[model samples]
Target: MTDLVRARLRTTVLLIVAVLVETTLGSDLRIAGVAPDFMILVVICAGLTGGTLSGAFVGFWAGLLYDMFLTATPVGLSALTYCLIGAAIGALRTSVLQERKSLLPAAALIGTAAGVLLFVGAGDVLGQTQLLGAGRAWLIRVMIVESLWNAVLALPVGYVYAWVARGSAGAERVGSPVRRTSRSAVPTVK
Candidate 1:
């Protein structure tokens, strides 16, 4: 399989794992009643490393999965939010963002804030006003804390993504020959 295809398949699996982790295991891992948004972190990582389409695709699936696990909001709410977040982050990547140092964590931090707002707004529109249940102060607190958590995860997640995509470890090596199944590379990248 081509590297791009292998990369995308890896991203897809990660997305599923993220949904399971965030909604299932992660939900139980709250700090002051707030759990870090892992799905957003994963999608942001994918987009920052994998490019626009990859971001959008992963974001949509990850969001949908999260929606399924979290609330009764319409299935596509999180999907649409995450999809847009991924695309926006990917587009931002093309211009001033330096992938060398500023890319991964920056994307994770900003995207996490945006993703939280987007999800909350979408939930509000869908009549899940409970998102605002904590009130504005609590809402801002959620955003700030979640953004911080995502930023903390950004480096490690981004490095793992780089390893999966380009076989990187800071300015060290090029591609290390890797094994991949060809079928895993097809539908996702196309």
Candidate 2:
């Protein structure tokens, strides 16, 4: 089998395992009245490592799978939120950010916080008032705690995501030598 096929297989297997773990042990691993969202962590790491399109694609599937297991809101809610979040993170990484050891945790921290707000806000806008039923204070707590949790877990998850995404076009771009484009000596008229 080709390396591309192998990478896709690895990514698929990783997502499956992540979904299983998030659905089963996720609740049991709760801390301070909130559970760590492994799926979101995976999505964020995928985005940070794989770039915009890759992140969005993974986020869509991960959110869709997560939606299947959710009873609180409509099926597409998580999918939309996660897709946007992943895409945004990936775009940011590609444009504004550089690869660094601390980037994983920072991305996880910010991504989770953004995701919580987006999920709740989108749910509320979609008339899923129950999402905001917990009130603002609860939302704040969840955002803080979840972000922290994701930040702590970012490194391990990032390593796994990198492994899974290996051999793909985007993955190969990461950690490789930066390519410089040749510039013309003469400036073109607008």
* Cα lDDT of model 1 by residue, 36-127, tens digit: 88888777766654456767987898888887875556788889999999877766654445434544666678999998899889889888
Candidate 2's TM-score reads 0.87
Error of 1 at 72 (Å): 4.1
lDDT, candidate 2, 65-184, per-residue tens: 899999988999989989999888888876776655577788889999999999999999989999888799999999999999888987777667766777765552232213212222
| Candidate 2: segments with Cα more than 4 A from true spot | 169-190
CA deviation > 4 Å runs, candidate 1: 166-190
Clash pairs (backbone) in predicted model 2: none
In Å, residue 174's CA in model 2 sits off its true spot by 8.2
Estimate the TM-score of every prediction. Answer: 0.79, 0.87
**Cα lDDT for residue 6, candidate 2:** 91
